[model samples]
Target: MTAAVDTRPDTAPRGIRRKARAYVALTKPRVMELLLVTTAPTMFLAQGGVPNLWLVAATLIGGALSAGSASAFNCYIDRDIDRIMKRTQGRPLVTGEVTDREALIFSYVVGVASIAWLALTVNLLSAALSLGAILFYVVVYTLWLKRRTPQNIVWGGIAGCMPVLIGWAAVTNDLSWAPVILFMVIFLWTPPHYWPLSMKYRDDYAAADVPMLSVVRGRSIVGLQVILYAWATVACSLLLVPVAGMGVVYTVVAAASGLWFIWEAHRLYSRAIQHVAEVRPMRVFHSSITYLTLLFVAVGIDPLLPF
Candidate 1:
């Protein structure tokens, strides 16, 4: 499914200053901010507290560029449907802030630049992993999966999980069970984290004909799935305690915050079960972000503690 080339006049912004903001918006800054939150902490765990500042800086920049590259391509690819969805209606591409050609070119240029930067500044393996993530997001998830099935995000979420691996690999230049477990934690966490947002935006997806889980399934079914995945996410997070040799801080925070996340997930299900007029799934969505932040913060902090 090819997105039609945007022919709208480039009235995105007249000043160079204004145009930079439009390009940044193409990266979906909010999502990138969340993606970045996971990067350094994993590096911390890999290095056991502090890695070289230069290496850390390089990995974060590479990760950001890789992520931004993918998002730009996504903006280009989804330009047509983007206009139909209210949440995405004001996107630069939709508003003619950036032309399709510019978005497409920008995606490739920054994407290639990121790979080169990583390979030179970081390790080849980390760079390769970053490149793979870019390709998977553009080729597999965005192009093929997003519009095809209700299970789109379930598998497509693999791309989002790459930063953990990339961050770890950047430090160690190799793969191990620790990062893999953390990867699985994010993999499981994604569905529950995203489904609530999907639930809130179900109508928008429905109108756009995108088959996100909430659009295809009832709220009760989606809530049940959220609960199931929330449990799986918590289980996966605990594995880090042993696999990564994490200590008391991580163990306690993981266990406690996980229970709270599961409880919130249950609350969403309970509301759905009761056929409430409005099930506020955003509660779970926002909590999921906080849960992840706390879990990873502990991951970063545990290694620095004397205990």
Candidate 2:
């Protein structure tokens, strides 16, 4: 007698993969990448050269988890507004790819795990800083500032600056002027880096009743503010050369890339002031990423160079 053969397709693996991707999307991986970019280089600078590979790896992992926790919490909190904004409508919570309850649980789990991971693998200071960052982003920025103030990103941006301090503390188990200056660099850079994206999405923000600077202010005023912040960012970046005793690589890269960033900001201002139909705010948005990447790359490289 021949045995009966069953031919049923396996759908479990596919369903699991889809759910995994939705959970990762709740973490905002792109934003996490930018935060990690600042972490390792700050570690390198803190070490005054290439740091211990294990320590660097541990710190980066902890930092990523912390950032992921903050972003997931933001997604859960902003789900209502996110649905109304075209730019955010595709987010996992907004798209129903992840439920509000699942996102909240994931955030708390990841947050507790990050603090524990840092405390065990890195140091208690790094863990505390990571916890502070999570609280600032979730409580201060998401709950208090985001809906009420156009200056939300300005103060909210403080959470983003914690990685530099955390990186330094991981290496030295303490803080100093070098990390503080780097902290300020990111603090000043956040406005110029974020405002342009807000400009492009001004209408979506307005519709959501989120008071981003670009939504409440005129384009020309926003453009001018961008230019001002861009200048300040570049200026603060220069302070690292003296504060950290950086060499030719960082000095040249910071100066040249900063000039390019300033030029992009000014071009946007010119367009905004002219009342041009298309102000192309994204140009500065992309330029800011390039500037920060180049500056941090130099940060990582300068310590290794024999100068």
Which candidate wins on lDDT? 2
Model 1: residues with Cα > 4 Å off, grouped in runs: 1-14
Residue-level lDDT of model 1, residues 95-155, one tens digit each, is 9988899899999999999999999999999999999999999999999999999999999
Q: In candidate 2, what are the lDDT values of residues 1-307, reduced to their tens digit?
A: 9998878878899889999999999889999999999999999998988999999999999999999999999999999999999998889898888888999999999999999999999999999999999999999999999999999999999999999999999999999999999999999999999999999999999999999999889999999999999999999999988888899999999999999999999999999999999999999999999999999999999999987
Strongest candidate by TM-score: 2
Count of backbone clashes, every candidate in sequence: 1, 0
Off by over 4 Å in 2: 1-8
- Clash pairs, candidate 1, are 12-97
RMSD of each: 7.4, 1.1
